[model samples]
Target chain A: MMSELDDDLVARAQHGDAAALEQLLGAVRVVAVRYCRARLGRTVGAFTTADDLAQEICLAVFHGLARVRGPLITYMYGIASHKVTDALRTAGRTAVLHSLDELEGRADISPGPEDAAVAAELSAQLARLLATLPPQHREIIVLRIMVGLPAEQVGAALNLSAANVRLIQHRALAQLRPVANEILSEVNP
Target chain B: MTAHHDQHTEPAEVQHDEHLAHKLATGQPGLPQDPLSILLAACRDDIRAAENPAMPLLANAAHVAVRGHRRRTLLAIAAATLVSGGAAAVVLARDAQPGSPLWPITELVYTEHADLALIRMALGDARAAITQGRYTDAQIHLDEAARLLTRITPGTPAQQLAAEIGTLRQELAAHLAAPAQQSEPASQTPGARAATPASAGGTTGAPTDPGSPGQRPATPTPGGQPPVPPGRDRPQPGEQQRTTTRGSSRPPR
Candidate 1:
């Protein structure tokens, strides 16, 4: 639904409609926020918030709007891909220090009473499993399953055909299943 | 998604995994209690529970950016309009006459070069008035032309216009000094009609004499004034000589 609205808004914005561009920025910001949240779910000491990363992506999209030739969502996701990757690299550099800091901060950092601690662990495990895949396959799965974009949009974002996207996704899920089954047995038993 | 499902199923386990992946990707309902479905569902549930404290701030930032962008765009358009509109006004007002509606614009944009146009316009009015036998009205226009000639740029065309103004002023003076009082000045006696010399002398005193404000009082108050009255309260011609380049519409070379 948002992808459809994005296409129409992209057309209007490219034709110099500022209101359409604003609306498009807003819609894209929401999706970017979701993608950043899902991808960065388990970073230990998030020096940068997912919303900040999403805001950065929206700003990049706004600045690069005139140069966009393909779908606006695809262009926006392309920016998202780079920003998230840069953020992850930064987080990786600080991971050991953050982990040491987490030891002291564990009591304050406990999952809240109303929240499911197992869900947080499971989300971390899922992120770890996803991190094991190749970058392109990981991106496809994230955009397809986690971000809930249609396969066609994922294909467009990654510059692949939809059929290729499905093939990659199928192979990716097959690879994830064994490890997923192992995690599932550990969690359930 | 279904099309990809039917086309790529090789085995039962693969088909089952593909179905689960499809359900998760498309957010379909009624999933089986498979290992992958539970794992993915737990991940989705955790992500859904993740705090988004920055959503409102992000939204506000987007609004601010949009408003700023809109303001910048409007300012750009306004600047372009001012530039292009000014150029268009100069172009349209190039041929405007002294008393025509666009005359002020012409005078403003083509300040140094505009005296020639002003002289031409006054000459045109004087010629038109003389043909209609309004001698006092013609004298007023010729006087305006003579006043313009005092500070007009010195060039061949200006010299030509000055000579034409000279001849027209002389002819108008002769016509006003005639004894007939034939045209519209019903109250003027012969002695009052003899103020054509004063009108002609006003132009000479305008360029050389600084303290003579009362010299042209009788010249402007005559009964047979032109339909479009002269600017009696205008500044002195010496003070009005803003001799810039006048680049807009200078005659050839």
Candidate 2:
């Protein structure tokens, strides 16, 4: 699902166009941040900074541009996923995420906060729900929802057919139904 | 979506899934897309402004990539030399510029750059100085690089390195000679914009044997007129031995 522009950027980056590398990473920074934030979930504020994690991923991607054999997103996601998973392994040792029973009360939604925070609260709730699913399903939902990549692109990155991407996304959303129904309904437009 | 439990479905179910899929891609409905935008903005700004200690990292990385390529090239060439009994492909990758195969790998290889690390250090110094409007310092460091470039044999494997230095010298010379080009890079350095005008004002209006602008910038202009006493600036009305600094102020102290 690599776009022609991304392919061009990647080619230029590999050829050591420093500005192109800078631009390529700048273009993808948002997605990388989203992925890292989702994977970090509740651990973001406590265990690691999402910005730092995303920057680390960018540095890795920048340095490793030559090793990319597939779409740029896949290579980026691969590095971010590894970094997040490694951090999670360490996180699981000392900290515990709220159990399913505690999920409702754990969300500290401030009444006077801006709508984006409310949106983020809902998104955080969704991320918690996403965490409950298996890794494969979780990845599809994040890339599809958080990163806003097309299923075709997601499918190409993940090596699944577009239909399979849709199917997995459907299943993943189904799993989030319990949390989504309770939290998202109350969010403002 | 209906929890039919079977992933395989009828066209009706497929239609439902498609509708749900559209919503799903937007993130659990009303979740305010891009939950991390604010958090990500800070990091993006950090990179864009080059405000971190790792700002030089990309330049180092370019060097690293070129080094890796050099290792591979040398190994390949060595293998080829052995296989062909000291015969090889044309030894000159002169056509390989920075984006080309020869330039990046062969031209910039550490061994090819005379004095290896010293030349790199000097070039980095020159680059930073150039970006800061310190063309004099840039010329000095570039001069060091050129001196090193000459130590490299003309027809040897490092000839390309010498050529690269020659190009850098020409560029540095241009930056040194042009007052206008010098002003542009000042904005790149911290506190340089403020310093640029002072420097430009100093050089431009220092009385070129006639009444000119900015002989004294930090002083006031009454009625927008210059504050110079008329005859005082023009050599005391007939005193001999008047000399202005070469392209500068303060009379060559």
> Best candidate, TM-score-wise?
1
lDDT of 1 at A131: 76
Q: Which stretches of candidate 2 lie over 4 Å from their true place?
A: A1-5, A42-48, A94-120, A184-189, B1-7, B11-253
The number of the candidate with the highest lDDT is 1
* Chain B TM-score of predicted candidate 1 relative to the true chain B: 0.35
lDDT of each: 0.58, 0.48
lDDT of 1 by residue, B128-194 (tens): 8776765445655666666667776688987898788767765655544332223426575556645
Candidate 2 chain A worst ten-residue window by lDDT: A42-51
Give the docking tier of candidate 1.
incorrect
Give residue B230's lDDT in candidate 1 (0 to 100): 24
What is the TM-score of candidate 1? 0.49
